[model samples]
Target: MPMSEQRYLVAARKYRPQLFRELVAQEHVTETLKNALRLDRIGHAYLFSGPRGVGKTTAARLLAKAINCQTPLDQREDGAEPCRRCEACLAFEEGRSLNVLEIDAASNNRVEDVRELRETVRIPPQGARKKVYIIDEVHMLSNAAFNALLKTLEEPPPHVLFIFATTEPHKVLPTILSRCQRFDFRRIPVENIVARLREVCAAEGVEADDESLMLLARKGDGALRDALSAFDQAVSLCGTRLRYAELAQALGVVDIDLYFQVTEHVRTGNGAGMLQLVERVVGAGYDLQEFVIGLAEHVRNLLVARTLPDLSLIEAGEATRRRYAQVAEAFTEADLLRMLGLLAEAETALKQSAHPRLRLELTLLRLASLPHAVDLRRVLEQLDRLAQSAPEAPAAASSSAAADPSRGRTAGLSRLSTPTGSTTPQPAAPGSNLGSGPFGPPALQVRPSEKPGDSLAQATQSAAALMVAEAPEASFETLVSRWADVVQQIKQVRIHVGLLLEESRPLRLMHDTLELAVPGEHAERLLRNQETFLITQLHAHLSEAISIRRIRFVVQDRSVAATSAALPEEPEDPLELLRRLQQQVPALQQLIDRFGCEPLWQGN
Candidate 1:
């Protein structure tokens, strides 16, 4: 706390690895070097490669001391161990080892430095086993320096060992790499980093919680020293125990609970709630990028928890993991995937964007409103629900086919077409009982969308409705395709609708008739709502003289969801499903007339 002691000691250096055993997440490098020393298979030159703060330089020094220790152990022969008590070890610890020469290749990267190094390697050791040269950041050495060092590296004296360490090993000459025994190091995993941080904290006598420790470990990003430095700051900032708020404020990280609340709101299709939460988060003055990263991570957790179902493997703490599990339970797998994709895209936007706040808010808004989007699954689920809840309106069915003149049913009402030239057939719902009991045979023949008794005049009315919904477009094909794309966009926000939409395929592109076939009648109602608006928009967007005369909703007899539950439960959004059906099938002019039942398909 004194003025002199107040000088900043970056987290990186304060916890720099001083001993081989102190190194984190580079056991392969350390163990291999220790083995070489123990086995006397020490190569003339060694290459240590990995990311920064991952012990490349530290490993180099440790190798140097082990090789040239004054009282070098037979440990490599015994078991790859270093003798810490020897004079050479003592000298190396003091940075005054006679035989161990450490060079920063960055500053001294000229040919002259290589020349001097070459001369030094030839003299052999005055007091150690070998004249060991340690070059840190050898990638920074000049081309000439590399070439000058190559020859000696190829055939150094038996008593000389060259150890080169580099964060960017690719920058080091290939010739240099090939000549040495390469040992690759990797960035420590978060778990390893946390363990190391705990060790450091214990040594420093700082009391810390798992959450705060995990935060520090994440901040380290595999760097033990960085985590320790952050730990030091956290300890200083909040004394012994670190509060989540203090950790967030000190680290510029958003509160985990904010992320929890926001993601929870998103799961339930609460756009207003999400917006309110976002306003609060932004008002807290948190960096938008940080929040974006956290949101992406939060979504990712939900995704993994939903799919994997193994909380132990996840990288969050118990509290965070529980929160993720709860959120994951609320969402379907597809929902989480869509949100994750959105968050990821938003992360990119945040990075490239100058206005992070705007990007963040927009991303949050997109996620919050995603449930309103149409998805194939949602559409399918809606169809299933409609089949379950809708009663057998036998008279309504007979009247429906009898009323539309341009429509007719064939093959026992398997297929139906309206008088407007729509040939889509409405299929029976998966578990809908056509007979006496649930899932029984067809007791009352489910009539098609078009009636056999529909006179020409009545057919004209049905056709007129279809034409009114269809707007003028340049090409019916383009209109329908673009409509499908919009439905797909809707699906991006609504997974259930997206699924059902995927099932409803377009059959025919008539002049004023768009023929679409769905798996069942439930899909018919789904296509009815946006049926008119989409037709209008299609005409407007393409500017063609194509009218969406009718969305022919024909059902396929086979139930896609039959393999699972007996009855399909209603999805959250049914209107989107109807739009999907209409977009997928333009010929089914009477989707609303057929499956537009109450409770399931809310008329929009």
Candidate 2:
């Protein structure tokens, strides 16, 4: 092959898209541009803005060629494409077209440059019908220069066109932006870039695996030009026989295995393996921050793979994608989210840290040690299922859960207290058990009649029920008739409360409030101590029985009448009570004699 026939072209330039239809990942811009050209509704100025290497300037060039191509078919239905064989297209491709000019705004951003441009715009294209000027990084233009060109850009000669391209569109003057039809270019997807790379490789007769191509695509960070450049470097390093290992090593990239190993270490709780992986990466001389970034990406891949159905969003080979999906199953979406968060924090901190390697190691350790964030809703659902299957024994389950090793602290998802949204505790239902379990109280027995060794809760519930039924409101006389029954019921429910009640004389009944005359302050104190509980029981007894919603207990000072009514005819000494108990209950006398018990407390 002759030198003229066989030419050398780098991947970036050799494969650059020349037509509106050929530009990658810019359909919105291309479709609109083609429609505008087809409709002959061309604007005087157009703005193309996006991140670097995402076809901004390229789209501008293609637009210029599409409009300037001389072939009659070029402007037909199969239009918006440059006839590359035409003089206009040929000259434009060679960068020698007098009809089109590309100015680097970073270098020529002064007011004088704008003046020169204005002067040039006045002259028609020497070869083509219209002249187009492409200003790259137009945001670099000085304010004065932007102002100088604003009028010309807004209403240029009919034969002139201006195209502005910028990564930072916000920095461009609002006046200039208003004068142009702006098009935003998006970052090309990694899959698209990889597909393009595969085409390039086949055309070049080079052998590259999917993993190698995937890695190259991700290295581009959504920039096809950058991905091509990286691909070119890979080709240069290994001369087209592209093995993933050599390509990765030549680029000094952390191998995918390291990230995989890091995740595996996290799954298995192996901090040491992660540390060794770091050592291997450091020994290879890769940047720790870069490693952290890659780890974050790895976690991101897992997250998307786990949570989303579209595997195309993940940039990896089929095998790698399968592995990601598999590992993703081991991790919940919440776990992957937590992992990404930790890695991102580490990556950010590494930028500000004095010791990046140590920070990275700490991050790795943290990730490896992260207790998987389990979804509490799912855990609760499982617990509910278990509860239903076994028996309705929350009390026993709760007690057992307190002592059960399996119930202690679950890994991955630790216990978290959630708001039950209830203000007061609800008592157990009539026949249901409270907290009965192997570790809790026995099943609550709803006996028809009271039996020996019944739980206090059951007995209290029974007494409360009986009190509700029998303690009805009546006139003072009827109420006084039931006072002894109230005392007896209280004695059965609680001996101490009943004893305190025994020291009060019913003075008067005023509505639901029971005004009691107490013999002394000692009895009054006891009543006040159990006031809330006593009132609940009293209201339960009195409420529906009377029309009372609440019942109040009031104790007044002992008058002679109250003292006389409340005081039982008895021995004045405490010893007299002991003597009475000894006489009434021989078992109490026997226990007292056996222990040789002495009176520790004496009443006045």
Query: Compared to the true structure, candidate 1 yields what TM-score?
Result: 0.64
Where is the poorest 10-residue window by lDDT in model 1? 408-417
Model 2 lDDT tens row, 1-604: 9888998888889999988777888899999988887788989899999988889999999989988888874444467677788888898899888888899999999999999988888898887879989999999999999999978887899999999999999999899889999999998998889889999999999899988998899889989999999998999899978989999999998888888888888877688898888889889999888888888988999988988888977878888888888888777777788887888788788889998888988888888766544233333344444334442333533554567556322211112211135222233343333222211242223355743333323333333232223233334555567667777677778766776576566676544566676645555676767766666665555544433333344546544335446658874666765675455433345457757986455555
lDDT of each: 0.67, 0.74
lDDT of model number 2: 0.74
RMSD of each: 17.7, 22.6
Query: Using TM-score as the measure, which candidate wins?
Result: 1
Model 1, residue 366: distance off in Å is 1.6
Worst 10 residues of 2 by lDDT: 410-419
Clashes of each: 65, 3
